[model samples]
Target chain A: MKTPGEQKDRTWILAAPGVGYLTVLYALPLGLLLLASFRLPEAFSISAYVDFFGDPFNWYIIWNTLRSALLTTAFCLLIGYPAAFALAWSKGWLQALFLVSLILPLSVGIVVKAFAWTIVLRSDGVLNQALMALGFTDEPVRLIFTETGLIFGAVNVFVPFMIMPVYSVIRLLDPRLAEAARTLGAGPLYVFWKIILPLTVPGIIAGIAFVFSLALAMYVIPTLLVGERFMTLSQQIARSYLYLRNETLGSTVAVVLLVFSLIVIVASQWLAGKVRANT
Target chain B: MTVLERLARLAVWTIGLAVCVYLMVPLFVTVAVSFSASPVFDLPPPSWSLRWYEALGSKRGFLPSLSLSVQIALISTGISLVLGTLTAIAVVKGRFPGRTAISTFVVSPLMMPGLVIGIALLQFLREIGYRDAYTGLILGHVIVTLPFIMRTVQASLSLFDFTLIDAARTLGLSYPKAVVKVLVPVLSPAYLSSGLFAFLASMDNYPISIFLTDARNKTLPIQVLEYLEVRPDPTIAAISSLLILLTIIVLVISDRLVGLRRMTDF
Candidate 1:
């Protein structure tokens, strides 16, 4: 029942709880991570960084992490782009159905999805059963306990992330440009490759950044599907903290992961900016 | 048309549909396995039954975890709604300095890896001597869920007209009165949808919650993970199917409250 000015003031005051909560919970924790990254461990030493960067095994872990993430992103894009395009170009009811189908799996828990994949990819899983029935393979294949299974689950979980962004961009794209390219004697392939692909680069970049970061930090799916033999950096960190009871090493590994993520984010932002300027 | 061209289109559609099937197959299998008359995880269920759902009722650990998850999700959603709505108003309406940076910082948690957040929070909490506590878990969940609410509220605020507010002011209504009378009603759908999203995000969260949860305070996702580690049971499928049904219910309610199409961008 207050005046407009009073209402505005009240609303601002009401917003304080959320703002303060975020500042304390989110901003402070991030600040602590940054601070912990730089602090000297026991007697003013740079040992954490040295150990993280100087070790070959650590470097291999980093390399494997990036490799897995890149593979996941690449596969998601290869599968998602056409799926997104088909969904975007489809009629109204079909588009709605496709979009719902694409996103429904996302609502399932990450652990649940990973479990589902285990059931499908195990030696006696549905996939092997299907293949055997179809005479594609005479024996059960080792799929679940490998990098292939990890990537499979990662891409399956992340494809929706990839599809949503690209679909948004594709939905907003000027269809006339494609038509003009075709009218100007370009074939369907050329129009797709030249016009549509370039226009959706922002979305592509966004999707890649999203999927890469997610796949990098992924723990549940890798643990459940790929198991311990092929440990990602995240699993290594978890093992360090929970199993090995090594907080310092876990913190060090976490900081390294944070740095890698920031680099990817910064690089993506730069690329997006350049693309925006050029377009 | 050449064989290759016809084959190429066919292959593309085939792959597309295959991927779709791949996405849905696991979920359908989980649901099917949950209702299986047999208790084993291998092969298709010989017959369908309601035994797993009945077993879910007797599982002492499962219900506690389910209740804990629901409680945490509700609390987190309630907090997020209040904070997210207010923050959205301030970000959209306030003439504050560094507004853009502040807005970005508020939502930046969305981009960061959940495991990194969990680990960082664990370390941070340990340093401050607050490790493995409900307060820590709540804070972590809030940080993770804030962006969804903020984004949705921001979108709704952007779509809102300022002229009505100004006119209400001119007509001698207080700011609070105007907002309560006009703005709240207008943004209610956005607020509700965002709240539902925040709830789901909190409920399904595992990485962040795993670090913060003590033995006494396990969430449903963590419980599911722990149980699966020991034995792969049809009860896990039952629990998953229940969660899926919950999601569908939320979706249906949300659709009724605010058309599902409006929530698509997020």
Candidate 2:
């Protein structure tokens, strides 16, 4: 076998091509984003940043974007945790059924899912028809073009993001840990709270980071579901770029979204570090 | 089981099965609606008809965008597979300073939102005066897909036996040839699943593709959304159903080639 030093020396050769491409494509583009935000039509200035912050409407939308994203993340966790636990604990065909059911939805396009939800959530749609038939409501409830509908769509679209990470972590847990807790007179809830919860914090953190970031940046769902009535930061960015033709404004919005996502990434990493230190 | 334990298990199964049903319903609705004889989307089709599927054929811009999407996905996935495999080898086997940093950087695109990357590329391309839509799209998709390939290959490589390469080398095969003979076969499952997943990811990509697409070069998702805006009917559903069928085929083949768990255990 080659010495560690020799192997290390050879790594640059293997890694250079990929790293160089990413630097040129990924890093440079982000740099351009930063620059575009600062450099306005006239000259290099923070006028766009000033303009963005000056508008309280913009602030509300940013806050709204984050709030909706948080709600989506919370819903994903609430639903996904139990489902993930079940998947982790199950065996054979039951597990296979759940896996296929979940993965198949995820593999399909977000556009397709968004389109599908529109069909189901429309005023005269399937859900409304079902509700009326079941005597829940006399008329079609206003689900489409509503925040509730968007959240429902976001959760349906993103719950898998939560489940996959949590399931991966939970599946690796030794069954003996739970069994030992049970033998010590701990109830199921107690065992989960004291043992499984602590162990799975990393996955939970990762899932939140992922779902939150994705929900924050999601353009397709909001565009298809709520449109201009409920403008997200992502929608605003796309609008400023494509519709408004204001590149500076779009870049400013993109920077804010990017910062929020970066914060999620860093927070997850920090939380994971803390979790590792505790164990 | 205790009564409470039984109730808890029942609740878990109920929630799990409910979640599964919730996930499947939308796609089911779309497919069902596509078969409806009515002009509008309706669940439990009034009568089964292939009209919408046939409508997909005459839909202007549908075939061209679909072809463009397929072309970009294939090209980008191929590039990512080669580059990602090389990078994974380095990350998994190389012992270098800042290796962790490099690995993180390689996977960083996955964490970043597609819109940010899309907008960033839009500005970057404008600055560089590189206005070719096709080139910009392939590059953007490469960014979108590299992480999946790298992660899967790295995972696969960790379980691979390097001694097989040594054995082949001792049997008079050259070093490169030994890797081709031994390592490639061992890692084929990773290649298969990642390639398939990456291809699907690229095909489904919208946010990134949106910014890069020119007037004539829209990706399939963009085209579908545009078409949906102008014409609200079962034709989009027909396209979606076909895409869903494609996704199912990909999943089944990947599951058969390598357990879905191996692909999904993230």
Candidate 3:
């Protein structure tokens, strides 16, 4: 057998290729991009940020991005919290079918999903046809290129994020705790509110962090479903890089998006940790 | 049971089933529309036909991109499987100062915004003088797919019994041979599921590939999105349905290999 020191020293070599590749190709590039935002001929400057936020259009873009993500998260939470229980408690073929439904949609490209929403939200689309058939509307509705439609598509795409985390948490929970509460004469509502809710806060925070962060940065869904009718940060970044060829603006916007995602991830981890420790 | 509890149970199922339908709606619509005789997106079909599917057969526009996407997906998934296996082994077995940090950093790319990564890499590639779109895409995809393999393999490796290696070794197997005989089989399921996911992630990648692809080397998703914008037709549904079919096949195979629940747990 090798010496303990030799073994310990050699062990990290296994990770060297993956770690080195990411450090060189992934991490280094991201670091350079961050540096690019502050680049100003050997002196870092806040002029880019000033120029960006000084425009009212940029503020609107930020608001539009966050608002859509917020609404999407809110909807995912409302829909997913109950659905997770159904998925967890479901039996036999139903469970497989439900699980497959979730995976199938996720596996399909976001571009395809966004395109599908476009067709569904069209003026003469299936959605409008159904509404008319049900006599809910006398005429086809203008659903496409609307904020409501964008959120509908985004929530559909992201609800799985919420359901998966919460479902996993529910699986880890001890059913007997609730059973004991019931046995002690507590109502179902009280048992759920007091016992179940607190335990799953970590999962909920995780789901919110995941869905909100993803939705905030989503490009394809917003691009295809709502198009130029709505402007979000992602589209602006793309425009700055691809069309305007303004590296300064693109890098600046990217750093801003990165900061938003970082805050969400770090905050969620801290929040989940606190909840776990407290419970 | 109390009336309140029963009502709550009913409500949960109602919402749950409804959400399932909601999730399935767009996919169901896509498949349903693909088989429709109508030229546009319509429900229940004006008539049932395989017109769109037939259209896909003769469609040469997507062929190059389709093959490029498949190639990239295969190559990148292969690369990730190797690198991720090593990384997982390191994290699981090696005594390290920053194992947790290493894992978090490796997996962070999955959670980071794709467009930001795309732009960063685009700038980096420009600076590095990455001359070919193909190699650039493979690099981008490796970063994209590596996390899935690492997470799954690490999860399963933690569950693996290292004593099996010792057992095999005592039976006259070399250390490498013992690991090959013992560890590989046990971890194959994790490898299969994670590799499948990584492949799919690569094939479905848009944001990264968008920044990498030149006019001659567009990926399938890029071409498909372009077609959707320029020509709003059921032909898009035909292509999309095929992708969904691929996903179903993947899911079923994974369900057979490792139950979907366990797969999700990783």
DockQ of each: 0.47, 0.69, 0.70
Q: Please, what are the lDDT tens digits per residue for candidate 3 over residues B215-239?
A: 9999999999888778777887887
Give the TM-scores of the predictions, in the order they appear. Answer: 0.90, 0.95, 0.94
Candidate with maximal DockQ: 3
Better of 1 and 2 by DockQ: 2
In terms of lDDT, which candidate is strongest?
Answer: 3
Off by over 4 Å in 3: A1-10
Give the C-alpha miss distance for residue B170 in model 1, angstroms.
Answer: 2.6
Question: lDDT tens digits, residues A1-279, model 3?
Answer: 457667445678999999998999889888988887889448889899999999999999999999999999999999999998898889888888778777778666788888778878888887898899899999889999999899989999889889988988898899999999999999988998999998888789978988998898899998988888699999998888888998889999999999998888778878876887886
Comparison by DockQ, 1 against 3, better one:
3
What TM-score is obtained by chain A of candidate 2? 0.93
For model 3 the local lDDT of residue B174 reads: 100
Give per-residue lDDT, candidate 3, residue A159: 95
How many angstroms is residue B228 displaced in model 1 relative to the true structure, after the best TM-score fit?
0.9
Per-residue CA lDDT of candidate 1, range B153-199, in tens? 88688878878988998899998898788899888887776776678
Query: Which is better, 2 or 3, measured by lDDT?
Result: 3
List, in the given order, the native-contact fraction of each candidate.
0.45, 0.64, 0.72
Per-residue error at B206 for model 2, in Å? 1.0
Per-residue alpha-carbon lDDT of candidate 2 for residues A1-279, written as tens digits (9 for 90 to 100): 566655335866788888888999889888878876888444789888898999999989998898899899999999898898888777888888788888777655788788888888998888999999999999899998999999999999989889988988888799899898888899987987899899899889888888998899889999988889898999998899889998778889999988888888778878888899999
lDDT (Cα, tens digit) per residue for candidate 1, span A1-279: 446665333345545777787777666776776666657433455677897789888888888889999999999989888787776666666655675677566567888889988888899988899999999999998998899988988898888778777877888898899778767988777776789789999989988888888888888988998778886788888898889988777878887787778787778778988999998
